[model samples]
Target: MFAMLVDFASPVSLDWLTLSVIPILFYYFVYTIYSLYFSPLANYPGPFFAKISSWPNFYHSTTGYRHIWIWQCHQKYGDAFRFKPDGVLFNSPSAYRTIYNSRANVKKGKFYEIWPRNTQNINTLTTIDKSAHGRKRRVLNSAFSEKAIRSAAGFVSEHVDRWNEVFLADNDGKEWTSPKNMSKMADYLVFDIMGDLCFGKSFELKEPGENEFRHMPHTIAEYMQFMYPASMITQSPMMKFWVWLKPRGLDSLFESMLPKNIRSYYEFVEANVARRQKEEEVLKRSDAEEGRGRNDLFHYLFNATDELGNPGYNTDELYAEANLLIIAGSDTTATTLVGFWFYITRNLRVYEKLVKEIRTAFDRAEDIQVGTTLSSCNYLQACIDEVLRAAPAGVADLVREVLPGGLEIEGGRLPEGTQLGVAQWSIMHHEESFGDPWTFRPERWIADSSTGVTPEDVARARSAFNPFTIGAGNCVGQKFAMEELLITVARTLWRMDARLVPGDNLGAGSSKLGWGSRDKNHIVLRDAWISIKDGPMVQFRKRVD
Candidate 1:
């Protein structure tokens, strides 16, 4: 029987290689034609290659230009465009609401699942089920309550005060300190703050002395770079195979593939969580009052209760959420601070105005805490708003999958099973929203008739501005984030005078960075869900009376 089968194939000289290649090539050709002219999304405009495959999205992600690529497409294609064969991206405020609002007929895109280590590791951010997300969010909300925020403010102040002193090192009050990379400084400060709050012990990345965890921030960035594009590949033609493989052995494969730095980050989070849990157990056993009085974020989460009054999270769940808090709490704040320094240092006029407002708002640096007095500083808030608008930390879309019955957006209806979102970078920089979108003008946020920024102008801009995004999936800790920003900027400016190192522009965009990101004044960011950025090298001097 084997000899007869071999003799039959030898007649035409047909080989396994030719037979396998023919079907794949033929299938791709037919699929491309259908995707370009026959699919529900055929009418959407975008790059030709993007209309047929997910490679464009994957390639741009690898280059750290995925956000820019989306913006460039929107510039050519108008408010809506196809980013992947099955994905559509929008560049309007209404579209954003339609996709992400609480009542929107959509859930998180499937690509979100690629980030979790396994089913047990899925946290609030990666959960695709709407009901599961809601349950998780409710329990997590306890950690960011009004009372928790008031307590968190104390931690913020402690870290910010120490951070400021570090800037003045190696300098006398009479002269400016050497040029410091504000990006790296911001990372250390925010990372330490997050470590202290979430783990009950500061990583102390900001201190002058050596520390083992000093490279953790860079490790986190490296891990994001690997995961972001890998997630995008889940939408490619290999989606089915990838999805099937994940539960079988891909989890172990990914663990093996991670670089040493990335592995170290995982080990660090695991160690910290284990140590904190043991400490909590001791406190609960010996001194319940001490455990109840502990005000770190982990305390709230550790003590959180479900509707039935059971513990909200188990050990595995706690370990998973620890990663979430570190990235969400630290990276978002640090990215904003980096962008703020880039703009404020270059624009001296704006810097002087902000300095006057901050100094006048508080009598001493210690007075700049989270309160009514701090909240009243309009310029400081405007500055922060402008930073978010121009250089948002999460520049890419928070993608979602259309549910059954589809969604109506921007004067058209999308079919069910469509993956879509608003490109945050494109929408925030769109001309329809901000007349001078490329300019860094905090005054755009302040409603002043004399400056020609009328209430209507500010309202229109506010409608389009969603740095923390909106609706159910919005940043759960937005108020806490704002409190940190306000305190960091206000206190720093109150104690020190900052200026750009002469002719240094490490983070600013240039012509070489390609279209939609060429303005020299605009700060450039590499999107990795959260942003990765560099410097606006700056020098600071103590404010003389």
Candidate 2:
């Protein structure tokens, strides 16, 4: 009986356990072998798998510097290099054109998936569906048109006036350094404008330091950094769950999000939506008053119509889309202006030329209005462009998934679904693409054949200088952002005499975070000491006669 029992079941069951584990081990082993030596990426060079994976990004990108890795990759492997097994970093001007201006066949990749407000609301600004995105864009497109922007100039002017009164009034009539508060100042002004124009209410962030709205920028900065790691995971649909599973990156970012503060900003957006809706109701009653008094982007956008041939977005959709404006329009303007300040301060000669231009153009600081600054200040605009080239949100390297048909990048055929983009840093710094790529020469942008850059060169460089991106997925707020940057930077120059407060520079003090989709450096504040968060502190003696 015992022998029968053993032969029938017992020994066989033991073998089954071994059999089960055997396949699992074998599968893993094969996976390792494929990843190491035989996968599609095996030929492309990069740091070892462990370095390329999420761990280094999670650790280095968060606590200290993530940009260093990108710089290292380009240095080690030349322009076209592998960052991860699936992701390729194309660090050339040509590659940038290929990735950004891909044929209509290739749409925006899954990387932008997290840009939507939430699960329920996917608006035009964030949705990847081309037709849907196009439809949404059509309705909203009118407001951002050049004429519309000219009309909205006063809106920015009003905010700058409010900011000047709040900050400059505290100077006690002496050329003193009061905590180089440009970063915070820039934040308040940008957020306030974003709030009022989009939501129809000003947070008034530029007041005496204690304003609750002042912290909105910091809160945003925190949220932006916190989201990317989770955001990176979001692009990987299958790995989405990993973000919430106490991954170190997720944990840090989640902790940083600080619901109380983020909700304040969220509440502001929600409130702005409500206010905008009420205004739209009034607008319908009197779209007749037209350009008389009520001139905000809200009126135009809310009253817009979609391709489905109906009044565009509903209440919630309006709210979400407006917030996209907030996210896209606000900090970008502030950051660009802030970065512009950094660049100008470093190059005192550029600073003098810009200031001379602004001061010569407008006698008073407040007199330097948006439309006027935008129209005549070619040098100012060029300076702004150079800054964008030097420090773009899409600067590090943008990624695009090659569609099913594959891509011909720089004469090489990349397989479909292969992620690629031009390295903004590389392209902007390319000797061939930019002439003297490192030199901060604004005259290069002036329409002149004498400088060796013809209108064709200008067009080529302009195409290459896509700080706001290009083609379908380009930043819809580019015009608005440009207006803001030019206005704000011009005013700051006109009002103050700025310089690098002695030994310090404009780079980030701790780590440059919150550049949404770029690898930025030295972007912190530096007024008194060389710290990044403190911002530039110039001796503004109020440019008296």
Candidate 3:
């Protein structure tokens, strides 16, 4: 009797287990069928698993190859392809303009909201609210005004001059310094400059010694790696729970999960903001305040007023805006500078043409200030444009979600709330838009008859090129970026000659990297929203007249 009772109980337990799992499996099977064959996005081509789940997109994002994956999908599936359940990417110039133009009926997707430190730390980049972003943007506009940028040129030149000195420091009177990783060097230089501009004092990360903040770049990169993937997760079908949890407990959980280095970075930013506020107060009280307070970018931000002529930002808002300025101002310029060195060092023709233009435009490096002569260097502009093309600061899509009433793009109407964007890497490399898109060609930007690049051809390229993006959400500090790039490239090339270390391709794509990143000539950038890259180790020597 006991043996018979035990046998019956075991079978009953087994039946219950089977009943629970079967329903789950059945539900998933039905959902997959609907997602692939019956949803509004059914016709969009994508990896089979990506259609069924968002895990594929999340996996690629965490691997830091999301950009290359999208490029590969575009190659196989044509211009428009689904990357996630509700996410579609378009790869054409017209599609880019249609989706991101000022008049577009779309707003930044929920992906942006994942960036702020908490609900209270909203800034220009993380805010999804249109009116709040507009207000914040108006305030930031004063921080990068023409007068402010002109004042900033002096600070930029000082930092660049000092950085050059450090590069040549232990040369031992040799023709060149030992091969320096341009990626690390550029980070140190740009971070120090951003420190000085955003705060009152420089971080001095480039000064070649013990510094508490030397690891800040690495901190920022790691932070981005985690956040970029998490942001993608929010756009998936599973995001319903995530969205519900964020306001309830997830924000605090995220803050707690921050690594020690990230916490240190936040502390550093907070300290700087406090110190700068104190100094601003003192400056406001001084009689010679007109020129007493240094006219750095921070000064402009501190003194800026709102539309109602009130202080533009309160304490919490200032901390948020100031932090964004440092990241945006520093990282973008550093990425471009590193990319410029990598490409120019590899391509001698581009290097020689650009150097000649800079040399001819200015008899002395000091004359390479931000003005008519500097702006007139067409070849210099072209080289910068090419670098931005080949290695954009942000390699991923500028994710935007359709607003109410839906929207039209590339001749197709996307339903409201669908997330879509033009992937920068895929669109810029579109063969139809740019002939020989993989090649590093700067002459394509010029309208010279000698190069057979006509005015129409140049216009066509311009239509596809959006280094700073365009319209309402365009980069506010574009002029500042251009000035800094112009100054850094011109001055560095003038004071020093540089070349890639023999057979050293630290930053170039290798066969081991797989498709869309196997070209030896192409600089490889890992996508973490803003690009993460390494180097083409280079050696530099002081230029001889």
The list of candidate 2 runs beyond 4 A from truth reads: 1-25, 50-64, 102-104, 115-117, 235-238, 241-258, 286-288, 370-374, 435-439, 447-463, 505-534
Put down candidate 3 lDDT per residue, 203-309, tens digits, no spaces. Answer: 89999889988899988988888889988888886675776677789889988987887888889889999999888988787755477778888788889999999
Angstrom error at residue 298, model 3:
1.6
lDDT of 2: 0.65
Off by over 4 Å in 1: 1-19, 285-287, 290-292
Top candidate by TM-score: 3
Taking all chains together, the TM-score of candidate 2 against the true structure is 0.83
lDDT of 2 by residue, 457-478 (tens): 7776765676776776777778
TM-score to native of every candidate shown: 0.95, 0.83, 0.96
**Reference-based lDDT, residue 542, model 3:** 85
Q: What is the lDDT of residue 78 in candidate 3?
A: 90
For model 2, name the residue pairs that clash.
507-522, 508-522, 508-523, 508-524, 524-532, 525-532, 525-535, 526-535
**CA-only RMSD, every prediction:** 2.7, 6.5, 2.4
Tell me which of candidates 2 and 3 scores higher on TM-score.
Answer: 3
Can you write out model 1's per-residue Cα lDDT over 262-356, one digit (the tens) per residue?
Answer: 78778888898898888777777876784365678888888788788988899989988888999888888999999899999989899999999
Worst 10 residues of 2 by lDDT: 524-533
Score residue 105 of candidate 2 by CA lDDT.
47
Considering TM-score, which of the candidate structures 1 and 2 is the better prediction for this target? 1
